[model samples]
Target: MLKHSDIWRAIDRLAHRHGLSASGLAKRGGLDPTTFNKSKRMTPDGKLRWPSTESIAKVLEATGSSFTDFVAMTGEEGDGTGGGAGMSAAAMRRVPVIGYAQAGNDGYFDDAGYPAGNGWDELEFPHVADDHAYALEVSGDSMEPVYRDGDIIIVSPAASVRRGDRVVVRTRDGEVMAKQLARQTANRLELVSLNRSHPDRSLPMADVAWIARIMWASQ
Candidate 1:
């Protein structure tokens, strides 16, 4: 039988595995920063406060984790690889990785934004269910604080992007940049840089070749 503590321990382990504190994990999951705080884990009267299923689901989605991974972290009978044991094999996919500098090069990607020929490296990660999923390696300090040098970001062309979503935008001029979507109109787009030192950018939508939403990052 699994105890409540076992579940809590699994959550803590999951957070640590992602190099995040409880509050950091909560924020990444789109929850209130205090959602996983120690105070929230117990009532003032000392009664245990269980995590909500919705919150767990959100965290799993944010972390690209399957139910099997969660169970493995619970010290279950299976190997603790967090490999999504109970999930389908298709859940694991090889994504092409490219440096930020190469991303702006022409002929590297097809018209649909899929990687084309050679000169590409690959990484295996949990599939985000997008065939156009790819990875971009951060190379400079332009996107620091949010994304450091050497961090790999997973981008999904098929993923729906909205205001506030981090996105990789390629322009017709061969400029590729990662920025937060500040505003989007049918004719124009406004982007906010991650680094405070950089100024916001605005571009005509017609100047963009493609824009993909960033799903996750391997910090």
Candidate 2:
């Protein structure tokens, strides 16, 4: 039996293989840009919203992928011998992890928010599904209750972030912070601290280096 997750995984893999985001793939296929977005994968009532055959066919044609390739990506090819064993393993990737202290240090990360130089530790985080995924280890109690010391958070620069999403933001002045997104606009961003001890902050968007959504956290 084909699972809804299986189909979506195939789409995600297809997009990644082509170096395109789900929306980008959709756009390339002449479909609405949000057709394959994560938010559209499920209905408002929490039911799975399976992609239509027409959309799938269009995307396959756009990317020059065949239906057979899509099936193999779903991990349903072969003689059903390996089953889903390889799927889980293939989904995971070694993510570079750095302590919050080291994150603020120079040369630890590049301009695009990717780990650049050395001193990074590796952690086997379960499928972030984003090429720009990285981990940050919390070191202080500034974000306690929600995120305590030693907690590892997986961030995805490729993920779409909205209000209420936990985010990691770095400023051009060298300030890096993890906070809940309160608001965002053309000129500024407002962030709220999980810990009441720290006051909410508002910064000019121009001063922000990069802002990535916190995808997952290891408590």
- Candidate that scores best on TM-score: 1
Q: What is the clash count for each candidate, in the order shown?
A: 0, 0
Candidate topping lDDT: 2
Model 2 lDDT tens row, 1-219: 779988987887776565344655676688986798778889999999899999999999987888988887775442122344544657668677666877777787789887786544455555678866887877678998898665678889888899999999998877889999999999999999989999999999999998999988744
lDDT of each: 0.78, 0.79
Q: Model 2 off-target regions past 4 Å?
A: 1-87
Error of 2 at 102 (Å): 1.1
Worst 10-residue lDDT window, candidate 2: 78-87
lDDT of 1 at 205: 93
List candidate 1 segments past 4 Å from native.
Answer: 1-88
TM-score, structure 2 vs. true: 0.59
Residue range 1-219, candidate 1, lDDT tens digits: 867777776776566456455655676788986787767889999999889989889888988888788877887432356354444547667677776888999987777677778646555566568977987877678998899765678889888889999999999998998999999999999999989898889999999888899999867
